[model samples]
Target chain A: MKNDILTVMWKERKGLFRIRGRRAQALLGMFSPVLLAIFFPLQEGVEWVQSPLSLLLAFVAPLILVGMSIPDSFAGERERHTLPTLLASRLSDRAILFGKMITSVAFGWGVTLVLLAIGLVTVNIAHWDGHILFYKPSILLADLAFSFLVAMLTAGAGVLFSLRAATAQEAQQTLMAVLLIPPMILQFGLFAIMGSDSGKARLQEVLGALSFEQIILVIVAVLLVLDVVLLMAAMSRFKRARLILD
Target chain B: MPSGIIFGFLGPNGAGKTTTINLLLGLLEPTSGRAEVLGLDTRTQPDEVRTRTGALLEHSGVYEQLSAEDNLEFYGRIWRMPATERQARIKELLSHMGVWERRKERVGTWSKGMKQKLALARAMLHRPPLVFLDEPTAGLDVMAAAAVRDDLEALAGREGVTVFLTTHNMAEAERLCSQVAVIREGKLVAIGDPDDLRARSGGPRLEIVGRGFDENALGLLRARPEITAAEVHGDHLVIDLRQETDTAPLVSLMVSAGVQVEEVRRGKASLEEVFLTLMEEER
Candidate 1:
């Protein structure tokens, strides 16, 4: 199983790096995170490492990266006429699924970590506080967990969308829309809560009641569950015969 | 099911040739029946069957974005060939196909013929006991098709691999396949050695090329007990004779009818003729 998965990964990685005519799109994908990593660290000074809000960058970074990559990996294989041959190989269905998912998630999560590290160094150098400034351990852990979970979420949803979409562009569009729903709902929920004086007060009271660690923990748990559900959904949708027919 | 021969699966488009190949490779499950490959039940031991066989599917199945060497390297690893041996084998196969110098170039940049050759090399790289090739020379120009046919002939002969080839090219099937199976609409029509099929479809045929043939002459020829069927084919009169009987009587009859016979040649029907007869019989 390990060897099979690795073989799929090797192919996935080769395809990812060897993409043609999409370099500009790839750089554009990295542009936002890179700009934020540099500009935010420079503008926010040492506050960049001290605030829990920095977790937003971590989450969105991977969401964008993995969202872009997972669809291309899955639907792109079908569109480029390579999926049937790969399915005909000795590799099991799970091996192909997990291999591609891991490659995309790792790429997104790995690059986010790099950007985070670069952001930290940039902040330290610009502020020159005569001490090495770093994100608090709690915030760092939250960022890692959040970023990894979002990457998995995007990848899982991407797989599901790619399975039905006739083209990579269609899958990417559908997956991006799916990924945006939760945040959009959250924004509406927040607006509803803030619209009422008593609701706002109660929300603040509850927030004040719970420790920051507890909030971060709750968020991580929710994301973890979501990631698992989406992963299972994607897995159930994948079948060698179905894919061949498709 | 014999060992070490090029077995041709002949079928027309939409005749389920690719589906059959997929079934044997264990990539597709039969709706009712089951299949076995290399002694492994395809349904139960699909992975084993796939690991032991190779396929150049309908589309060549080559990664166009990668170099020829990379494509072979990837599949070699899939077959778990060792590093040294894999490299040596890749070099050997590419060199054998006369595409060694272009191995470093991406397959997308190569001509369709070269890509087909590379794909064939990849299929033979692991030297599996069985290989499936679907229309390997389907769309190539005459020269390119001949080149690919030569390569296929050489590799099939040299490696002693069992080739399950699918094609609509009757001439190719006649030349390369020792045994052939004809399928139409998901059903097997005939399966046997090419010669047997040609013989079974009809007995010896006689072709007389001359312009002095008319409907009266054809009617007279068809009336003979030795000739089963007679028709004007292009500018010639073709007769399907029964039981290797002499054509002298038919020729004498034609002469008596004031018809001229420019040439007389007697031989078995070609595979194309056999295939057409099978399809006609099926319909």
Candidate 2:
């Protein structure tokens, strides 16, 4: 099973990097991340690593990156007419699913970490801090865990959308729309919460009651359950016969 | 049923040929029946069956973005062929297809024929005991189709692997298949040697290219008990005779009827004619 997963990953990586126009798209995708990694740290100095805003970067990085990649990975295979052959191969359902998911997650999370690390170096070199600048252990842990969870969430959702989509572009667009819904709902919920004095008082009381660590833990826990549910849904929907018919 | 023979699966469009191949390859479940490949039940042990069998599906299923070598390398890994063996096999297959020098070029850049050769190489890379090829020459030009056919023939001959080949080209089936099965609407209509089908698909046929075949000659030819069908097709008189009937008597009768017979030919029905007749019967 491990070997099979690796084999799928090998193909995924080759396809991601070596495909004709995809190479250009990938390089272009990296441009924004590289710019952020360098410019943000130089501008903010050690505060870039010290603040919780770095966690926001980490979270958004994976959301964007994984959202972009997972659709291309799953829907792209079907669009290119390669999915049937892959399905007809000896690889098990779990192996192919996990292999593709892992590749996208790894790419998103790996690049996020690299960007954060580069940010650290840029802070140290350009800002000329007397001592080394790095993320606090708690902040770093939150970044890794949250970013990974978000990446998994995006990938899981991407698979579901890709399964039904006719083309990779359509899958990507639909997934992006789905991803925006959560934030939109959150915005509406926050507005409702702050609409009245009683609601604002309750919100403040809840926030005041929990420490940042406790809040982060709660968010991560919710994300973990959502990730598992979405992943399971994607797995159950991935039927070979259905895919072939499509 | 035998190993090391190229079996041709012949059928018209929408005849469930692809569906049957999918079931045999364990990509789909049968509604009421079962299929086995390489001694493994496709329903219960699909992975095992797939592990031992290779398929080039209806589409080439080649990654157009990857080079020809990388495409084979990818499938070779899927079959878990080791690095050394995979490299050697890729080289061998590409060389045999006469595309070894262009292995590094992207498949999309190559002509349709070249991509098909590479796809065939990928299908045979793991050296499975059996392979399924679905219309390997479906969309190629005349020269390209002929080239692919040559490669398919050579590889099938040299590898000694069981091949389940589905093709619309009866000529290809006639040329390469040891046994052929004709299916229509998800059911097997006829399965036998091509020659046996041709023989059983009515009987011996005779064509007389002549200018003097009139209604009297046609009526007389059709009225005979031994002649099943006699019709003027363009400038020739085509007659379908009952099995084992001699043509000499028919020729004598036509001459007596004042029909000018410029040339006489006795032949078995071609595979295409048999296929059309079966479809007509089914309809």
Candidate 3:
């Protein structure tokens, strides 16, 4: 089983950037993350490393990257007419599922880490006041754990949508729409609440009751639960007979 | 169904050929009956069954963005073949298929025929004892189709592997398959060797190239109790005879009736005719 998963990963790695026009899209996609890595540090100085501003990059980078990848990993096989052959091979279901999930998470998380590092370097160089600037220990931990969890969330959701999608582009479009909904609603809800004086005071009071560490832990726990639930759903949906019919 | 021979599965569009292949490969489970490939029950031991067989399904299933060698290498790893052995086998199969020189070229850039050839090589990479090919040469031009057929025949012969081939091309089946089964509307309509099906569907036929095939000769030939049907096309006369009817009497009767007989050829129905006849019967 381990070898089977590794074999699938090997294939996914080879074909990662080989999808038609995908390399160009990837380079184009990198532009924003690269900009964020450089721009935010220059604008915010040491505050970029010391505050939660970098967490935005950490969350959004993996979500977007994994959103772009997991669909292609899953739906691209069906669109290209390669999934049946892969399923017809000696590989088991879990092997294929885990292999694709691992590759997508790795790609998304790996790129986010690189961008975070680039942000760190930018801060140290631009703000050469004294010692090298680095992300605070708490922020660093959140960036790593949060980015990873987000990648998993996207991958898990991507598989479910990809199974029903006729093409990779369709899967990506649907997945992006679905993923953006929760965050969009949250942002609007925050805005609506902050618009009122009572809501603002009540919100601050609730937040003030908890330490920063407890809040971070709460967010991490919620994400962790969603990740497992989505993963389980993906596994249940990844049956050989079902995929062949699809 | 036998070892060391090509078994042709013939059917028209939507005739469940692809479904049967899927069931046999254990990619889809049968709703009613069970099947076994290499002594492993398809429903119970699909992995073991798949591990020992190869399949070229409805689509070629090659990664167009990858080179021919990489395509084979990926499946090779899926089968868990050792690196050195897999490399040697890929080279051997590609060379046999006459695509070894272009192994590094991306498959998407190649013509459809070339891609089909590469797909065939991928199916045979593991040297399995049996392979299921669903319409392997379905949409190729005449020359390309013949080339693929030739490669399939050679490889099957040299390796002594059993091939379960599905095709709509009757001439291809006549040339390659030792046994064939024809299905219609999810039911087996006919199953036998090509000759056996031909004989069952039709009778002896005689064609004589001649002039002076007038109505008199035609009526006389048709009136014979042993003859089933008689027709003429310009200088040629065709006669379908009852089983075991001697051609000498028919030729003499034609000659005496003033029909000039140039050449006589004896044959049975071709596989195409047999297939059509079976389909007509089902309808």
Candidate 4:
């Protein structure tokens, strides 16, 4: 099983950038994140590394990157008529699922790490003082955990959509829409709560009671649970019989 | 059904040829009955069956963006062929298919025939004991189809693998398959050797190339108890026989009646004719 998953990863690695017209799209998709990595550090100077500003790049980069990849890895195979042959091979369903999920997560999380490094470099070069500035240990840890979890979240959700989608574009569009819902709801909930003085007071009271570390830990724990739930859902749906029919 | 012969599974569009192949591969479960491949129950041991078999499904199933070598290389890895052995086998198969020179080019750039050939090479890369090909030559031009057919025949012969081939091309079935089965609406209608099916579908036939075929000669030939139907198509007289019988007496009768008989050919029905006859009978 391990060998089979590795074999699948081997193929996925080759196909990641080599697919027709995908290179251009991938480069174009990287443009925004690249810009953020450079522009934010230059604008914010030392705050980019010491504060939570870099976390934005960490969260959004993996979501977009993994979003672009998981659909293509899953639905693109079906759209191009290769999934049947792959499923017909000696590969078990779990190997295929984990192989694709791992590849997408690695690509997304790996690229986010690079972008974060680029931001750090941009900040140091822009604000060259007596010493080089780097991301604070806490910020760096949060960025890593958040980016990795977001990558997993996107991959898990993307697989579910890809399994039912007829085309890669459809899966991608649907995944993006679904990913937007949580933040949209959070924004609305925050707005509504802050709109009322009493509600805002209560929120600040609750927040004031907890340390930043506790809050970060709580969010991480929630994301970890969601990631596991989505992964389990993807595994349950990734049956060979179901995929063949799809 | 045997160990090392191409068994042709004949069916029309949507006649469940692909479905049956999926079942045998364990990609789809049998709602009722069960199947076994290489003595492994498809229901209980499908992975084992798939490990021992290869398949070229309805589609070519090749990655168009990847080079041909990469395509075969990926499957070679899937089967866990060692690096050296996989490379050598890829070279051997691609060389045999006469596409080794073009192995570095993306398959999407190749013509349909070439892509189909590459897909074939991928299927045979593992040298499995059995391979299932679903309409392997389905959408190719005449020359391209023949090229694929030749490759299939040579590879199957060289590998000594049992090929479970599904095709509507009866001529292809006749040439490549030692035994054939016809299915319609998910049920087996007929199963036998090509010759046996041909003979069973229609009786012996006689065609006489002559310039003096007339209604009078046709009438006399049709009156014989052994002849089922006789018709003159231009200068040729075609006689459908009730059974295999001596044609000398009939030729002598035609000559005595002043009908010029230039050449007489005795033959059984072709596989295509047999397939059509079976379909018509089922209807």
Candidate 5:
């Protein structure tokens, strides 16, 4: 029964994504994944880029894609007034939420999946100069699992934010501000605070010393639980009245 | 047998017409009143009702990007209509609504009338007995509105499907609705056949046209217990007389009051007048 709803949701969202054609949503989505791949990927091997480019490959791209895209998909629905229509349908609010959440996370993860493919091709090409990082599809697959969960978190948060904004732009803006802040902070070397580098390391250097894989797992797990809880919360707040007015 | 009732609901603006329709379709919560569709309470049996009902609430809700047939197919899946049935029904509905030629065309590319017609087709696609239409002709031109009215009338009269329709167009209501409930300010003012409501609010009307008509005199007639309505049309006063009241008495009252009376014509009450009078009472 749950899978039934999820399947329908996947179909519906696939339609939504297919609304304008995958030529754009899927392509434009690649933009962020590629940027993150180029910049966020572990450097060749500076004692910091751990677990072969393949493991880090599985983790970071999915996480970033989920964090960046899922919420925005919700904003798209809120903008299109499709949410209100969906709410009025026969499906229970939970089913609707679950379906929509699935779409968001799936799309987010989907984009990451595409990016991973592109990155894999590019990573192999880049490593042609005698630097062969560990090559394991299972490591990449595990990262995908974590990415899906994080995508749920972003999607739930986006939907919750959508309830507060009148239009898609407002929802995206509000969520974007919230979502962008953490990454900006992290980019500013704030992540260095968690590093265990012992000597001659400033704030960023120390944060950079911790293994990226451990950080990814802890963050993915925490975000996964929060995402599930927030989705339930979003489902509860997902009433017809709020949808029409919101 | 049709699983859904093409229930007919009619209410004027501000009468919670939109709100009521929304509630019926599970688009909104009823502040007090509860609605049941297909033997299911809208609140608890939303899924059952939705699956059974095909609604065109307000206007076109097409995804706009998809073609007309695509929209119908999408909604068909949502209603759990069979995959094999989806395409055939979409074609049938689009043809019935006279949009089959444009089935492959995007909804966003269609005109307002076309969009509305397509929306109606989509609503009727699932063969749901219960269809809720909230001013489906709202944005159409006169000819389109008439076409829609004809379609609704045919659906109800020929198909025997109960259609719940809400429209401010009294003529449309009179033509399309077997029974209408006039609502104002969230309260139901009157409920019955249009003819019955008109007949019940009856008075033999004396249509008098004359020069220098005393406007205040008509007001006096309205004040009288016997006069149900006194409508001033340019130089004429179309008066509705009470059952117990005779036209002779009105002539006498005018004579006694020293007023000149012109040609008097007795006429039946119109639904428009009856509803206007009902709304007046509500105000």
Candidate 6:
């Protein structure tokens, strides 16, 4: 099973790369860093990585961005109606499904890494008293790998939904709901909740109390569990998938 | 009779043909039955089926950016055919499908006919023992459809490849099919040799084409009680003879009637006719 999945993925390596267009590449590159820049806007006149939100965004941005690739991965094939051809091949459903999932997650990581590179370049170029902004390069890289795990979670969820939805639009919408809700809550709702709270000092204390290492481990744990759970769901629920209308 | 028997699936639009094809390929699970290919149950060994057989669905596609040769090679690799074998197999398929000249061109730019032939080449690239095709020539022009038909028939006869063909073209089915299975909605309404199904469905139906016969000659032929039913098919009249009836009486009557009998054929009804009969039976 492992060999079959890997073989199919390798065979499709060229075509899959071609399908990941410049738009997707650009989106992936910009998403992580831009989120970081937003949380710690460069124009805000703060050091690149000092802003907790920006630092957190950079760590979590890849996780969120990875999910975006999932909807397209499975939904794209469903939209093109090519699922049957693959299903009819000698490879089993689980193998083909997992192969697609792995490929999608790989792309998610690939794009996130590209963004990471871009972020590192921009941060290094920033004039920080002739100093690098983020102190934990190793940590960020580790977080990027964690983001890859989170991407597997999102990809698995997207594929499960994509299998049944009659049209790509529905599959995308289904995946979008799952992908967008959690990270979006973190992205937009965090500030909202913080602003509405009158305990400004308490929030500051909490922000300052955050140990970057703790956040890294927490995210990693969550990402690992999510990846395993969602992957299991996607593989198991595949049998129940019926082609449904938008 | 062999390990894998290629059954031609015939039906009209919305006749559950694609549904059946999907069931066979393990794409959609049977509503309440079983699908096994090569001793590997779809429910148990889907990957096994996928690796063993190659399929070209009704609306299969390839990345627009890649050349046809690349598509073949890519799928070949997925089937785990070694690089050297894949190269030789792809070359042979491209040459045989008559797309060798344009193999370098991106599939997105190919004509409908070119793409159909390329799809066939891709399906056969791995040299899978079993193949499932859904309306393989649904959108191809006459020449291209004919070419694909030839490829499929030759694949079955020469290569001994099992081709589970799915199509709505009655004439094409009759031309190439060794055995046929007709489905309606979701039920297997008929299954057997094309000739047998046609004969049983229409009950020994026959068609004659020539000058008209007078009632006296018809009466003489009918006196034997061999003729059961007859109908007009275009310019000629179709006659259905009773079981165990000989054709000598009809020929004698036609000759005596001074009618120029240009053709005397015993046609076990056509696929279309059989399907229509099945539909009527269902109704």
- Highest DockQ scorer: 4
Model 5, chain A: how large is the TM-score?
0.68
Q: Rate the local accuracy (lDDT) of all candidates.
A: 0.88, 0.88, 0.91, 0.92, 0.66, 0.69
Q: What digit string (tens of lDDT, one per residue) describes model 1 on residues B105-217?
A: 98889998998998899889889999999999999999999999999999999999999999999999999999999999999999999989998997789988877788888
Off by over 4 Å in 2: none
Candidate 3 residue B73 Cα shift, in angstroms, is: 0.7
Residue-wise lDDT of candidate 6 within B38-119, one digit each (tens)? 7779766655676777788777566455788887876786677888998888888888777888888878787877777777
> For model 2, how does the per-residue alpha-carbon lDDT over B179-206 read when each residue is reduced to its tens digit?
9999999889999998999999968999
Docking class of 6: acceptable
Candidate 5 docking quality: incorrect, acceptable, medium or high: acceptable
* Per-residue lDDT over B17-65 for candidate 3, one digit per residue giving the tens place of the 0 to 100 score: 9999889888898999999898889999998989999989888999998
By DockQ rank, best first, the candidates go 4, 3, 2, 1, 6, 5
The digit string of per-residue lDDT tens for model 5 on B44-102 reads 77677777776776646666767777777767776767778887887777777777887
Best by lDDT: 4
For each candidate, report its DockQ versus the true two-chain complex. 0.67, 0.79, 0.87, 0.88, 0.36, 0.40
Model 2 per-residue lDDT tens digits across residues A81-157: 88888888889999999999999999999988988888888888998847777788889999889989999999999
Model 3 residue A88 CA deviation (Å) reads 1.2
Shift in Å, residue B181, candidate 5: 0.5
Off by over 4 Å in 4: B211-215, B232-235, B256-258
Please give the range of 10 consecutive residues that has the lowest summed lDDT in model 1 chain B: B242-251
Name model 3 segments beyond 4 Å from true. B233-235
> Which ten contiguous residues of candidate 2 chain B have the minimum total lDDT?
B31-40
What's each prediction's TM-score? 0.97, 0.96, 0.97, 0.97, 0.80, 0.81
Higher-TM-score candidate of 3 and 5: 3
Ordered from best to worst lDDT, the candidate numbers read: 4, 3, 1, 2, 6, 5
Clashing pairs in 1: none
Q: For candidate 2, give the docking quality class from DockQ.
A: medium
Model 5, A129-240: lDDT tens digits are 4765433544564557666765666677787887667655576567757766766886665445445464325655645776656666667678778877887888788776
At residue B128, candidate 4 shows an lDDT of 96
Model 5 interface root-mean-square deviation = 2.9
